[model samples]
Target: MAYRRTPAVQARLDAQREAVLQAAVVLLAERGYGGCSMAAVAERAGIATGSMYRHFSGKSELAVELFRTVVGREVAAVTEAARRESTPQRRLAAAVETFAARALRAPRLAYALLAEPADPVVDAERLVFRRAFRDLFAEQIADAVAAGEIPPQNAELTGAALVGAVGEALVGPLAAGGRHPDEVIPALVSFTLRALGGSHDSDA
Candidate 1:
């Protein structure tokens, strides 16, 4: 006969799955992709190495899932910050600052997500999240252009450009364990504002 999972048993399994994912994230943040092996994750999760295969197919799948969960949360945070602002420039600035500030706060994880080399599966996820971030900026830029808050430009191109530029600028600091949030966020915000063709005197 085939076995079926009871509700209580399934809930416990779900919790264990979440625990495993969380352990992978912590390992990735501490040591990047290269250091986060299946054994390491299993050990960190307090599960036997072979037992990990019960929850995930292999390292690649676990890494990809970890990338999705963490990066998805980050993208949501910046998106929400931008959405809350009333103006295009303000929205852009909020997104930029929120992204930079949060990244600076978690330098190791930011570096892992933004710069570390990974398996093809995780790399694909990186591209998806990168585009997701760019799209958030693109939407705000399009709105700003329509409202004449900033000069008209190719919203798609500008949005992608901003994401690349800000991401590159943060790489060094994030790799070096980061600098003061106060210092990095304002600089990134000012740079993004200028790139968007807005005045420094205005709110970012």
Candidate 2:
């Protein structure tokens, strides 16, 4: 006969799963992928090491899941910020600021997500978020071009360039765990606006 969990038992299991995932996130942020082993996560989560496999097949699966969770949250934030403003230029500025600001606020996590070398699975997951970010920029660029806010440009190429430029610029700062060093968001906003031929008169 098949067995079904009682409501109370299922709730406990759900809470345990959340605790395990949270523990993994903290460990990953604190020590990068290399330091976040299944045993370590289990220990941090106050569960038996063997139990981790019940939640995740292995370290790779856990790492990939964590990557998706973390990067997905970041992408949502950037998307929301980008769509908040009416003008495409303002939306682009907001996107840049939101992305940079989040990275600055959580340098360890940001560095781990953006710059740390990881297993191929996790690297592929990183690429997914990178593309998501590029797409956000592409949408704004297309809109701005249509509205005559910026000159005609290859939106895809330009979006990729922006993502690469922004990620590269933040790597060193993120590695050093610096917060809002020298008005990074403003400088980035100004630089991005200028690069896209958008007006830089308004502060981002």
Candidate 3:
């Protein structure tokens, strides 16, 4: 028979695992990915070094798990931000803002997950998460075209261009110390709107 996890027991275990991963991300970001150790992660997590092994087999496995969690959260934010808006333009702007804000808030994590291929597992998962974002953006662009908000053009090319632009443009400010995500959201929103032939007024 298959083992079953009770809700409360599952919740507790999930929380503990998340704490471990959270500690790992902070350490990985502070130290280079290669520099982080299982001991350091265990210490940061307030658990015995052996305890981390119970949750993850090794440092590389833990790192991959953390990468998946971080990318999942960021993508969820983008999806939520886009979900509430009615107009395609608003959805696009919200999606860009969500991506920028999250990346800025956790720039190191963003750089690790998006910019570097530290591990094969991370590389594979990151590609999937990124492609999901691209497809969602392209779909929004198509909707905007259908609504006559944007010109009918190369949807995939347009989506990829916009996503790349936002990712590259924000990397600097995001990685810069003492800058808040809110500080750059408006500019991002404005730039994306103009590029898509939509006005910033759509957000108003």
lDDT of 1 by residue, 38-115 (tens): 899989999899988988899888888899999888988998998898888898899998898888888989998998
Q: Which is superior by TM-score, 2 or 3?
A: 2
Best by TM-score: 1
Report the lDDT of model 3 for residue 35: 52
lDDT of 1: 0.88
Q: Write the per-residue lDDT of candidate 3 for residues 130-197, one digit (tens) a residue.
A: 68788878988898999998877777778888878877787677457318666678888888888877
Query: How accurate locally, in lDDT, is each candidate?
Result: 0.88, 0.88, 0.77
Off by over 4 Å in 3: 1-15, 25-36, 178-183, 200-204
Question: What TM-score would you give candidate 1 relative to the actual structure?
Answer: 0.94
Error of 2 at 177 (Å): 1.3
Q: Indicate the TM-score of model 3.
A: 0.78
> TM-score for each prediction?
0.94, 0.92, 0.78
Cα lDDT of model 2 by residue, 85-125, tens digit: 88888998989899999888888888888889889998898
Superposed Cα deviation of residue 196, candidate 3 (Å)? 2.6
Tell me the RMSD of model 3 versus the true structure: 3.6
Each model's total of backbone clashes? 0, 0, 0
